[model samples]
Target: MKRVGSFLGDWWRLVIPYFRSEEWPIAIALLIGAIALTFAGVGLEVLFNDWNRRFYDSIQNKNETVFWREIIFFSWLAALYIMVFVARAIVSPYLRLRWRRWLTSHYLAHWLDDRGYYRIELTRAVDNVDQRIAEDLNQLGQYTMTLLLGLLGAVATLISFLFILWELSGPLSLASIGIDITVPGYMAWVCLIYAVVGSYLANLVGRRLIPLNFMRQRFEANFRFSLVRVRENAEGIALYHGEKREADSLNARFIDVFNNGFRVLMTQAQLAFYQSGYAQLAIIFPYVVTAPRFFAGVITFGVMTQTASAFGQVQTALSFFIDNYTSLAELRAVMDRLKGLQIATDEKPPTAIEVMPQPGRSGVATEDLTLSLPGGQALLENLDLPLEKGQSVLVRGASGTGKSTLFRALAGIWPFGRGRVRVPEGARVLFLPQKPYIPIGTLRDAVRYPDENSRASDADIAAALQATGLGHLTDRLDEVAHWSNVLSGGEQQRLAAARAIVFKPDWLFMDEATASLDDAAEATVYNALKKQLPGTTMVSIGHRPTLRKWHDRQLELKRAPGEVGTLVEVPA
Candidate 1:
């Protein structure tokens, strides 16, 4: 019972927010319409049950006139049933889609806000968030609507039919057995018992499906992610001749999917077999129990048939869980995954380094800044670094001395330490990494990115491209393609340099941004930065001796064998 309560609480948290959102009016209207249709469909089933009795009795009594009239009545009844269900089908799915849209937008905001995606990735706190957002949200919306409507319809059917079955059931006497006992509404009691037992057995057969479905989604996402990795890094793999290794790794991932899928299939088969036999037995069980009364001539053929129809309706309504146990299991798994993502994103990082805006300040500076790995090993300690406006400083360190991490801490992304980083209010800062991210889009957008709203005209963009020795791509500004895959490494670095030229940030931090370019090309890019944006404060991390001439001062990070590194000012 506690587990059930927790499951429902999680489901409510995931489902209720959309209805209370700005789209509530339309969402509520569609939901109410679908529910109204559900009740109308159940009401129509009652009418059909009555018609079944009239038609069958007409045939039993050889009354053609009454039989023909009842047949026409069924036609009208069937038409109304079709219209109600059709409207329900339309409204329900439309509501699901709208709910899904709202949820996708909401989750995307939380995941991207405050660089939550980066933190989640850096800490390995959650896995396959893309799948959770893309696939799990869709399933959550779909199954929530399906199960809610199904359960409501079941309740209505059960209420409407149970009374009819009871009234038609009458009392049964067992004096011939010498006990002289009587059972009231015997058929209703029998149906209630039968449905209860069937549901219990169905649950027993399919309870493992919940955990299996959860793992199944994870395995499938892992396999698909592996394929995407291979595609994205095709050049690296091909150059290293790692196709065979990739193939074996891919097969290994798929084996998890294959084995789990086989177990799901076998479990579903067991459930299907049980449900089919139960349903077939239900068909005859109703008439078999009530037939004795019909044979005894205590009721008309119409009453016997009506009693059987009512029995079927009540039994089906009670068997709702039995029929949908698998869907229920899948829904449980979806809720668990989405709830996990929600919790992970909502959590605040502990001991996060603080970055504050100091208005009226001229450039970036750090106070008592410390940096560490995710595993809590200190890299840099008690460092106070300050730079004034228009000052170009180069940061130099041996490999793994936290040069790049210091950049991240300055960028306010590395959260594994505590410190205060101060920057001027409303300062535009850009960090160009070793391998710049080239979004899959047109060349213009890729160059203007991290700020797609840049108003840099085509002429301005083209000039930046030419300045960075990428004049060949100027004409293809509007052509959309996967820029990362299309551009070579040196070309990509040059393109990133062009982006820096276009963006013209007040403070530009480049971490080996020119490492891939040739000496002449790198010189051209650095000279362009100096001439184009002379007021920009530059902090670069690089090992090349040629890089020293472009900066006014230098800071080197040095550490002993087992001590944390410290930054020291050095002559350029």
Candidate 2:
């Protein structure tokens, strides 16, 4: 009872969001329609059961007219049943798609909001959030519908067919042992007991598999992520001769995959041990109990067939828990992953400073700004910084000294900080990371990402690329490639700069966005920034001395013994 209650709790927690989403009306309507159709199909099942009695009786009687009449009756019933089945298939997948769409967007919204995805990545809180969103979310949505429909159909079958089973089978007797066992609805009771015992045994053998499968997914995702990391940094790895270590790292990740998979195989073998033999025994158990009466002329051939049919129905209903146990385990694994993500999304770092409102001020700004790491180590502390309209500056700090962290804080991505950041009304801010993100698409589409490609004209894109010294790319603007893989690092970095030139935001914060380029290339990117949007407030974090010349002033994070991150303003 306790376990059942807990399962219900988890199910509700997983399922409630869909019914409350913007697509609720369509989602719920199709859901209810699918369920209704499922029950309708099951109702035809009961009709078929009744038809079995009448049609077979006519056959045994050798009555041609009644047999033909029964045939016509069944034809109509079969047609209706076919209609229900067709409706179920069509509408169920429709609901599945809608649910998947809503769920993916919903999870993405929470996961990506305020760089929640980045936090999840940095903290390693959700080991397979990418897999969960892309793969598991779709499976969860689809399989959840199938499982719910199955449960409903099973329940409806059990209620309607239990009567037929009880009426068909009676008490059992073992006269050889001088024993008599009187059980009303004896076959139904036997199947119920058999299924309950079998389900318990299956769970006992398979319970460990739930955790094993969960770990297996995590391991596979880790291995895949490692491979992707290698691909992303293939040049650096080759230049440094790090192939041996990379191979060792990949081998270790595969080792994790191997061990987790071995455990799953062992547990599945244990399950097959019981379910296989149990299934083999099921083929004959009904006949052994009913054959004696049939041979003794107590029941006709039609009666024998009816008895077997009823036994199958009773057994199927009783074994619902047994059959669905594997799916339940898989569901548990998905639930745990999704539940972990939910916990992470709901969590807010306590160190984040509240945004202070100034009495006479009108735009967005921060006061007494302080930034810290997730471990509570301060990156920027007790600093008074202000930005006014048409003002631009550069922020410089040592590598990994939280210059990127400050950028994240400013963009409200990293929550582990103390700062009140304020910006003016109707101000649009864009943050450019070190590597430009080139989505897989036409060059035109990649340039205008986070906005539809149709929303931007190709001529305008060509002009921006030309201005950024990427005129060669302008001719291939409509061509598609894995731009990250196809374009050189310098070009990809410039592509981001070109994006800035095209978007023309009110403010742009570049975090080593041109680190891969040469001094000349870096100078060209900045010149493009200045030429395209001279009034756009620009703040950059870079190490090159030449970069300091691009900005009017610099704030460098100075370090000393016993001090990790202390920002010291650099004189212009």
Candidate 3:
């Protein structure tokens, strides 16, 4: 019961936001319309049940006139039922789509706001966030609406038919068995007990499905992600002739998917076996129980059939949980995943590193800054580095000495550290990693990335590309393609240089951004930056000796084994 309550609470938290969103007026109106159609459909069932009694009675009495009239009545009832069903079908899915759109937008904002996505990746807090946003949110909206409307319809059917069934069932007498006992509304009682037992057994048989479904989604997503990774790195793998090894890794991931999928299939098979048998038995069980009254001449055939029809409706309503247990389990799993994502995005992890903005400050500086690994081991300790405006600085260190991590700290993305990084207020900063991110779009968009709204003219973009020796790509600026996969390493780095030239940040930090380029091309790119963005402060992290000449000063990180790296000023 506690677990059920908790699940409902989580599900409600996920659902209620949409109804309260800016689209609430339309959302609520459509929901109300869907619900009205559901109840109206249930009302049609009651009318149909009454028509069943009259139509069968007229047939029993051989009254062709009344029989024909009931047929006409049934046609009208059937028409109304069809209309209600159609209306519900239209409104419900429309509401689901609109709700999903709002939810997608809301979650996207939360995930992307304030670099929450970056922190989530850094901490490894959740798995397959893309799946969560793309697939799970859609499923959540779909299942929640389907289940809620189904449940409301069930309750209405149960309430409407319970009274009709009670009145029609009358009483069961045990006088024939020598006991003087009369049970009133016996069929209603039987239905309640039968449905209760069926639901309990269904839950018992399918309880494992919740975790199985959860793991199934995870394993499937993991397998898909592995395939995408292989595709993304196809060049590296093909160059190394690692297809056999890649196949082995991919097969390993699929094995997890296959094993869990098999478990789900088997479990669903068990539930299906029980559900099918239970449903088939329900068809005749009502007749079997009500036939005695018909045979004894206590009720007409019409009364007996009406009693049976009412029994079926009441039983179906009571057995809603039994019928939908699998869907319930799946919805629970989706709720758990979405709830976890919500919590992860909402979490405000204590910041060990503090970044402050000083309005009049000339450049970026760190005070008592200590950088650490995720495991809390210090990488750099007690570092006080002040980078003044327009001063080109080169940062050099042995491999794995936290040079790139320092860049991340300055960019204010790395969180596993304690420090005060003060940046000049309103300063435009950009960090270019070794392998720059080239978004999948037109080359114009890629060159102007992180500044998608830049008003840089095509002529300016072409000039920047030519300046970086990528004059060939200038013609393809409007050509749309996956630039990251399409361009070579050197070309991609040059493209990154083109972006730097085009955007021209106030402070530019490059972590081996030019490592892929040859010395001549690299010098050309650096000279272009110097000549074009003369006032920009440049911080470069590179191993190339030729890189020193472009910088005004140098800082080297030196450390012994098991000691934190300390930054020292060195001659350029």
In order of listing, the candidates' clash counts read 0, 8, 0
Model 2: lDDT of residue 380: 69
lDDT, candidate 2, 1-572, per-residue tens = 89778877887899988999888898889989999998898788888877887788889889899999989999999899888888888999988888888888899999978677777777777677888888788778776887888888888888877777787776666555776655677777777777778888888887887788788778989999999999988988999999999999999999999988988988888887878877777767878877987799887667667767777776676677667767777887887788888888877777676544345553445577788666677666776676555656777866777788777777776777776777765666778999878899888888887655335577888888988889998899879888998888889988988888778777888988988998888888899889888868888888878888888767887654235567677898
Question: Candidates ranked by lDDT, best first?
Answer: 1, 3, 2
User: What lDDT does each candidate get?
Assistant: 0.91, 0.80, 0.90
Report the C-alpha lDDT of model 3 over 235-305, residue by residue, as the tens digit: 99999999999999999999999999999999999999999999899899989998877898989999988
TM-score of each: 0.97, 0.88, 0.98
Spell out the clash pairs found in candidate 3. Answer: none
Ranking 2 against 3 by lDDT, winner? 3
Error of 3 at 60 (Å): 0.9
Q: Is candidate 2 or candidate 3 better by TM-score?
A: 3
- Model 2 residue 199 CA deviation (Å) reads 2.0
All candidates: CA RMSD in angstroms? Answer: 1.4, 3.4, 1.3
Model 2 reaches what TM-score against the true structure?
0.88
Ranking by TM-score: 3, 1, 2
1-572 per-residue lDDT for model 1 (tens digits)? 79789889989998999999999999999999988988898999999998988899999999999999998999999898889989998999999999889999999999998888888888878789999999999999898888898899999999999999989999877788887889898888999999999999998999999999999999999999999999999999999999999999999999999999999999999999999999999899978988888898987889888988899899999999999999989999999898888888887667778889987988788988878888888888877888888889899888877889998899898878988999999999999999999998899999999896899999999999999999998999999999999999999999998999899999999999999988999999999989888878899998788889999999898866457888888874
